[model samples]
Target: MTWNPSDFNNTSGLHISPKDMWIPELIIHNAVGDTYELRTSNFMKLAISSNGFINWNTGGNTETSCKVDISRYPFDTQTCHILIGKSSSLDYELMMIPAAAKINTFLYDENENGEWELLDTSVGYHAINEQMTFLKCTLILKRRPLFYILNILLPVILLSLMNVLSFKLSINCGERMSYSVALFLTFIVLLNIVADEMPKVSKTISFLQLYINTQLAIGMFITTISVFLVHSTNSKTNDDVTGAVHAVYKFCKLCSKKQQVRPESPKGDDQHEDKYIKSGQCEKLEMEHVQQTPGSANAETNQSPSIVDAVNVIDDTLFWSFLMLFVLITIVFLLLCLF
Candidate 1:
């Protein structure tokens, strides 16, 4: 019996039987709108009976009906264009969807008369086919090297330099004020840089923020110590000046007292007598003063102003205070570096 074309879809011709002497072919199409046609002759046959019981045979196996081996087709050559859209939420929720895509499939086969059949169709791959598989995609996260340099290293360096200024500046009001101001400015700049890169989350403390705060604390401590040193040195200097003035006054008073106890010489005698009297009076006064003031007394009472001593005391105190401050600041800076 002749096969009725209207009774069977054209796709049924893709399957064949060995007894029927029919062949089957498969074709594939690509996304670039290219068609690849493949043909096979006598690949399938069928056993036709008077009651229309057609038995299909393929690969030396007889079946009740024809079947097509889709595996023989080059599915790899046919690819679909997949446009994926992804969105992420603040809570780390991710969503993805295929917004648009298209697939092309090509069919080629031979009829019972050995005629060729070729067809091409463009349809949504997912609409007609549910068995299509996709390859697993790997996601990678890459960070720029310069991001760490600018966002981390540069800020830390600036902060460290600001901290170093505490040691370089003099421990005076002017120097302290300037250094503190500069340190604060550096902190502000670093904070701004951190704010730009990090999310405004209440629960997190960035590395840059920690570093800036630590440096600011150290700078404040250094400023306070400097102020204390200046005040202490001035107070000590004032005390020394007061003590020196008091000693000088006491020495002058003792000299005045000795002068008041001495007696004068007689004046109405001859020239030689007057001269001898003056000399005797002077000698007596000297002896009496020497007798009253013994060696121990002289040793105890003698006081002389020493310019060198005053200068040395002032210089030594100031120098040592500044030196100690310098060393302390240096040690603190070194510790910060290590940490």
Candidate 2:
């Protein structure tokens, strides 16, 4: 129906009721919810050109099944697809074609989500089973991690630091058990909270979950060590303590002294102290210096360190070791999850 330009005030297009015309009903094949025909509402209009061509803009919301792999979690990207196919077997009477290979939304994405940003989109026509045709549209999205970092990730990391700090509390110290148990409980609560927001465990396990579980395991280890140290110290004598325990205690004693700055002695005593430091006799020098002090206790000065003393040395040794391990694990997990 070509129109004369001067006949209708130069109007080349007109709007009419969508029900008065035909529309290709594109349905989502992988829909998770009710699959509906992609037809414009009756309240909408179909623009008809003077040459009998029509423009039916059918844009609406859809729910499709999207499988997620959340190993990286808050730092991850997800891809979802919408498989649009004709609702009827009309391959001979009707045909569908993709508008373009790439779908860009710089002009029309006004109500975008705050937590996710669309990264890219592509659409293509595909045929299957020798007869069916469909439009496959892929959408890639990236998560904005700021909300998760503040609400979950940072608090978890901080709680893990508390686990490392608990090693500094002595076994006999009344606060040790309380501190360990409290930290362990905090992790449990946090894990449950995180799990609620995450995909089901049957789907895919995330790195964050594994990281937290490791921390819980370490907490159990520390608690067990504390229980054993408390029990053994209360029951064992220096004679009952094994040679291996004595050696570990002595090694830790030497290690602790190596980190200390040696005090300056008089001019004549310099060579004496030099011999002690060079020959690894610093422990002897320390013993002598304590004995010469004005009010030193004889009970602590002249005997081999008791089992309790050995326990103290072990505590200090474990403190530094576990601290380093915690630091290394935290760094590695952070790098892996973010990258």
User: Which candidate has the top score in lDDT?
Assistant: 2
The lowest-lDDT stretch of 10 consecutive residues in candidate 2 is 294-303
Task: Let me know the TM-score candidate 1 reaches against the reference structure.
Answer: 0.31
lDDT of 2: 0.79
Quote each prediction's TM-score.
Answer: 0.31, 0.77
lDDT of 2 by residue, 1-339 (tens): 467656899898888886777677777789876885677456668888888888877666667888888999889899988888888766675677887888767675634688888888899877765567888899898888899999988988888888878767766688877888888888899889889988775777788888889888888888787777777766675444566667777788889988898677667787776775586587677668877873756655445766877887888888898888889988888898887
Model 1 Cα displacement at 56 (Å)? 34
| lDDT (0 to 1) per candidate | 0.43, 0.79
Relative to the unseen true structure, what is the C-alpha lDDT of residue 337 in candidate 2, on a scale of 0 to 100?
A: 86
Note each model's CA RMSD in angstroms: 28.9, 5.9
Error of model 1, residue 98, in angstroms: 13
Evaluated at residue 185, the lDDT of candidate 2 is 88
Quick one: how many clashes does candidate 2 have?
0
User: Which of the numbered candidates is closest to the native, going by highest TM-score?
Assistant: 2
Which stretches in model 2 have alpha-carbon errors above 4 Å?
1-11, 90-92, 104-112, 236-303
